[model samples]
Target: MHLSEQEPSSWPQWLSVYHKRALLGGGLLLATALLWPTPQLTTGQRIALPLDLSSTSTHFSVPDTLEALADKPAFSTTITTGDTLSKLFERAGVDQQTMYKVLEADLNILALDTLQPGNEISFYLDENHQLMRLEIDFSLARQVVFTQVDGSYDVEEIQKKGQWQPKAVSGDIYGSFYTSASKAGLTAGQIQRIETILKEKINFARDLQAGASFSVALSEQYIEGVASGDSQLLAIHINNRGKQIDAYQFSDGQYYDANGESLVRAFLRTPLAKTYRLTSNYNGKRRHPVTGRIAPHNGTDFSTPIGTQVIAPGDGVVTLVTDHRYAGKYIVIDHGNQYVTRYLHLSKTMVRKGQRVTRGQPIALTGNTGRTTGPHLHYEFHINGRPVNAMTAKIPMASRLNKAELKRFKSMVSQRNIQMGV
Candidate 1:
């Protein structure tokens, strides 16, 4: 109880003893930890836990492994105007022997006979640059394939499944209809079709003005989720100088206006698909080039190359197929209602007398067989036995559809109207 007065030395001794004992205990604990082995846990004895995948993102990729595995080189090209299959094969580095073999292998493969522009042709060549496989796209939905088999070639026709995708385009004309339509992504073929449908109603070359608007509804072909670059025009609406023209393609494959009137005319302005220069006009009392005498130049003259296809301007019965000293080889088509068309100086005549011909049918070939000084086509349009300027004359249109067809056409094209936003 009174140890506070005499515990100074005893306190020092107690503190020293306690410090040594604590140090000894710590060293012993460390030694035990280092010497003892940790217990190993098995899969069955481990605790189950949930994985956290919320913060992770998964991705997928498709590699073109087949293309990588192919040893030969593949070349593809589009057919252009005046392109031949042999020329294409040469361009693809195929040898002449291989080309001849492919050609002689299949006589029924006439796809190369009519080489349409824009068709695709592909070639696969081996290490020796010999053609091993060839693929020709006849159309968007059809292809012909030729593969080397047993030192020969085997041909196979493949039909592709395609879907129709509705497409719509609209634009306003600032200059020419061609320029504006091209800017709106319409091809020349499509523009020509539209012109054919509306030529009777609107003179595109003369009547189109600034601010005139147009809308076109068509279908684009899609195969395997890829567009095949082929399109079909379905419906069109044109507002030209406050006049509205609507044309819809019917199930019968003819274009009809909103009132069910056929857009095809009885006569086409030009007989040839290719445009030509007006060498001479329909004139009376003109000095003849050969005779140097005043003669009546009754027909219009178009200067074109020899063998140019001449088409029937209208549906009519062939009245005369004869050769004269003055007119040379000529054809006379007698359209009813006191109308007649004459094509003079042809190299070949395809239609015979008394044969029925439709408009746009090829009837003859242009030539220099007549008494003319140069190669040209002499076209004459007669009305009631008198020659009139076909380029400036007002040609009559074909008869319109009856009331029942009009109703049905309107009903069938009602959805097209909605799609065109009419």
Candidate 2:
């Protein structure tokens, strides 16, 4: 209809209608937004969630392990010069109080007071640096253990079981007996015993030739499948320039020949039981070491370590025990047959004058007490008050074993000889 000309009066009515339509359209738009579909999550999609720390219900705690706290480390050390047990313990981080406690726990700990070089000791410490265990090697076969038990120390002595294994070694002398014997795996103690067994029969320094040979059968000690340093010589044979000298260990712990004769002679060549070098011979005219003047050196000198045991050459009475200007601390033994043996430069005299001593008995200790430049033993032999060379002079032999003892010794010798393949 052509309302433009007639709608002036009806304008309010038309405006009201238009307002009602606008309201209806706004309501429809609101409903459409409410009913619309949203996007959905896929099956493999991941979503990072935020932590909710506001809850007071959750808690965590760590569990303790007692085994870990009980473990400890062990320390081992060898005793050296001037090293004491207290110092050694300190080096292992142990306190003096604890060491003293352990030491006072038992009387066996007294052995540690006599410690020497080359001894070994071990320590075990806990996490708190407290000494838990201590082990000391008293010898190759003996050990002592101090353990912490119930907050106190307890001591125990353990003796190791050792096996004795027989060993045979043979060698020929090229330059010196010591050199050749060492090359054949002979220990120093073994070599010394060998020399002593043959001392009465052969002069090692003079009688040993280039081709002189020796054989020894010994028993070596083994502990826990390891070789220990203890040994015993069972038999020895020396062949010097086609002369054979055999010695066997009898039940009496002394060496005897195959004919049941004692290997110990009437007089020992030197006062020392161990092997040593001859520093000076019995010379009528020679230059003295300390004085540097020509003099009659009436005695033979043996170079040895200080404090080595000086043994009696024969059974005799001690006639003189005095110190001299040239001879330091000297001892003179007088045998009944116009024979006398003198030992000079002694560190200590173990015997007093008028005391009777048997052959091979310790009479003194070697030292540098006299007018000498070094540590040695000056030994002199006199026959009817006349000085003679002890090394080359004729020396008598001790009486052989009695008939019954000889018979038993012969049987033992036969068995040992078969074992030694002699």
Best by TM-score: 1
**Every candidate's CA RMSD:** 31.2, 34.4
What would the per-residue lDDT of candidate 1 be over residues 83-162, giving only the tens digit for each residue?
76656654555555666556543322333444578777766543233456777776777787777765556566565659
The top-ranked prediction according to lDDT is: 1
Q: Which stretches of candidate 2 lie over 4 Å from their true place?
A: 1-74, 78-86, 94-119, 124-133, 138-140, 145-159, 264-405
Could you tell me every candidate's TM-score relative to the true structure? 0.47, 0.46
Ten residues in sequence with the least summed lDDT for candidate 1: 40-49
Q: Which residue pairs does candidate 2 place in steric collision?
A: none
Residue 250, model 1, lDDT = 75
Question: Over the stretch 297-354, how does candidate 2's per-residue lDDT look in tens digits?
Answer: 7788899899999999887778778765456788888764457788888889999987
